[model samples]
Target: MSRPKPNETSSGFESPRTDEPLFQPSSEVWYKDGNTILIAGDEGFRVYAGMLSEQSSVFADMLEIPLPAPQATHEGCPLVWISDSAVEMRYLLKSMLDPRYILKINQTLDLPALCSILRLSTKYNVVHIRRRAIEALQHYFPTTLSAYYNARERRRLSSGGVSTYFLLANTCREANANVLLPSILYSCSAQQLDTILDGVPDSHQGRVELSHKNKSAVIQSRHQLAHLARTGTLRWLYSGEGCSDKRCVAIRRRVGARLLEGRSIDGFVNPLSTFNDALVELIDGDCCEACQNAVERCVDNGREEVWKKVPSVFGLGSWDVLVKAYGQE
Candidate 1:
């Protein structure tokens, strides 16, 4: 579709005259036959009104309202100004307009696109798009222990390092996808203390910080999980009951000493992941077969126990509650 020049108004109807500059129509989103032009920020998207109304109840009601006097027009289409970032609106519009944009089975959306689409879909009552976005998040931050381990092993979960957890946590709250919070917040608690408290820099939004309530929750959970890591999850290290082999006993003692001295290979914040690769290799490679089996059983049972406590650790109740609440939604 050909866009109008800056100073040129569309053919038939007079434009809303103002000293403020007109929005630049989005090249990617503009449709020649579209009847409505939705302006978000300084960008205008010419899209079919009927299509939008069919997908979003909020848009349906908004478009039905009569525009008084001279209506705003963009490229001869009726214009409506929306209070959302242009980038976010573009993501939402594409997801709604293109059947393959969001629903593709093999597609992996980056964090920003996922959050933006989820937020707008939730706000506009676009159920399918919102559900798809939430499913993507669940793939990364799953509710079950086995599923989480599977995702981690397959390298499907992207933490985006420590900073991204803060962004994801806030987005989950905004979209009301609270079921993803336990794993997301656990990732937040895994970061360094100062990093958690000071927040992290985001490319688009300067710095992102958790809400005060969540900040406290993660910090407290960090301490609690660290304690559990030593006393509960990794207690096998210090339990002094390995196999009869002297070498295996020595390896266990060395690893236990390191953990006691606060020099653990996996760090101490995440109890559920305390048996990381380094520790796993130490137990599996050098230890006697009986000792290896013992450690495996302990690690499995301990990680599951810690995983079950995760939601409660962050004041989110339990897995059953979260599952029920999300189902009701």
Candidate 2:
């Protein structure tokens, strides 16, 4: 690793400055039999024209336009300047060159690699490459709450907690994945307020920042989630009051009150499980059979209602919209 070179000033103060090289050499592994060189930032990659042309029409069209005279050359090949990061270029080029260089899917991928493939592939007009990258990300950001939990749980079991949802959400917006916004917004609402503002860093993309629109959505969604938890619970408890067992009903109401006391659905790791457990414990000797059945039915109905309204609660459109948007993939 190169250390920062110290520069002495007239004020007798020494400051570190990075002396970046003018040009970076192409990697031997990537400099295989080639006809063109793609220079990204300071790095150079010598790759075949035919391969790039086959995968990307943009590259093909560019290759067809004959250059006047090459200002720069890498090992006798004409250099094509690209403003993209060298890391992204390498990833994009490697996938096009090597058949067995499998991009990760159905699992947690390095955020930068995932982002690079999605962004660059879309830019280069590589339809299949872009589609695969989009699909891999969609696995994490589903359209519905049930699908979200299922994917989240599967990921948790397989690889523990991955804090890439924020980045995934941002990437989806850039990729024009509006259908996934509701679930992604809900996930954001469940995060710490500080995380929503400061954002998080990943190995590949460095600090993945949230946009202003997403931040505003998060703030609004947080209030909506809390409101739903409070009012929805109360609504279910009072929906049916003509009960034979008054004491049992009173006890159930007390439990519901305690569970819903200034508490937001965001706080519950598994709201459905928590609600079910809280009510199930009351089915013992203390509560009568009639009250138990009533509580069971009430919880079931409340959960169904909540599931149906969860999208609207978070300022999202209906489930039909989410389903339709998901199908656009």
Candidate 3:
């Protein structure tokens, strides 16, 4: 079917008058013989109400509202006004109607497309798109350090680096995805201070900005991470019962020397990875079995302890509160 040219109103009346209002349709592709026209801002889209209603309870409810005298029409279809970003609505509509544009697990969506789907899907209560968006984000920012390391490594191998965690942070809030925030905020905190302000390309939603509270929280996380590097880690490594043994003492000395030489945690965004690296170094050294086991235990304990504090580090509530907010409870 050929695309419908822009008509000024729901009536589809072509007026030769100079006063004919400016009208924009989404694209040639979406202008199907679809029964309903969705007008977002100045851009109109011809699409199926039945398909939208099936996917979204919100749309079903909206469609249930009785239509009065209709002014705008395209190919005998009524034009419905949508108070949303035209770009976002376009993306959402495409994701629903176009098989090729549909979101999938293995396929990567650039930040703009992902953000649009997330924003509109959340607002319109489109569950599938929202789920896919959250899954894609989780792939980028997994909750556990091991998972995060695996995902981060995969991302690095495939696309390089993720510099849009800050943008994801806001989108998570918009989408009621608090579960993703702990990882998102941590990733954002890990970014270089300058880059945090500049933001990554394609993640900008209107303005690429962080809340003042979040900015301070990131700064605090850096400071706390530094403190953990200097004292907390070293203290944990040396304050051991096995230290009485000469072999254990030698192991501690070797690890401590490495730490002092800057196997430091100053640059680590996730404390678990930092601790894991330290454990690996200790294991490589000629440490006694007892000391090695003790160090490993310390790493496990420290990881749990740090994870519990992660939410607070980013100015959020305790873990329990955050998990409940994310509807995990």
lDDT of 1 by residue, 1-329 (tens): 22333333555554554566568879879888889999888889999999999989999999999976467665677888888989999999998887777675126676667778778899999988888888887777899988877776333344454556787787787777889999888878877777888998877788888878779998878767877777666777867655657788788777766555764233554577645653676656577767776777777788888899999989999999998998888
**lDDT for 142 (candidate 2):** 59
For all candidates in order, the CA lDDT equals: 0.77, 0.64, 0.66
User: Compared with the true structure, what per-residue lDDT tens digits does model 3 show for residues 247-278?
Assistant: 76776777666656653244443355456566
Model 2 misplacement above 4 A: 1-31, 41-43, 61-70, 106-112, 157-163, 201-207, 231-235, 241-246, 261-277, 280-285, 288-316, 322-329
**Against the hidden true structure, what lDDT does model 2 obtain?**
0.64
| lDDT tens readout by residue for model 2, 1-329 | 23234466565555334355434665732666687887677677888888889889999998778764323455677767677878888877776776655445324555446667777887888878777776665676555545665677644443212246666566666766666566666666666766777877656657666777777777776765555554554354665543657777777777776665635434532233327655565665377766666666665555555666766765667888867765675
Number of the top candidate by lDDT? 1
Highest TM-score against the true fold, candidate? 1
The positional error of residue 285 in candidate 3, measured at the CA in angstroms, is 6.5
Candidate 3, after superposition: displacement of residue 46 in Å?
2.3
Sort by TM-score, top down from the best? 1, 2, 3
Query: Between candidates 1 and 2, which one is better according to TM-score?
Result: 1
What global local distance difference test value does model 3 have? 0.66
User: Which of 2 and 3 is ahead in lDDT?
Assistant: 3
Show the lowest summed lDDT stretch of 10 residues, model 1: 1-10
Weakest 10 consecutive residues, lDDT, candidate 3?
14-23
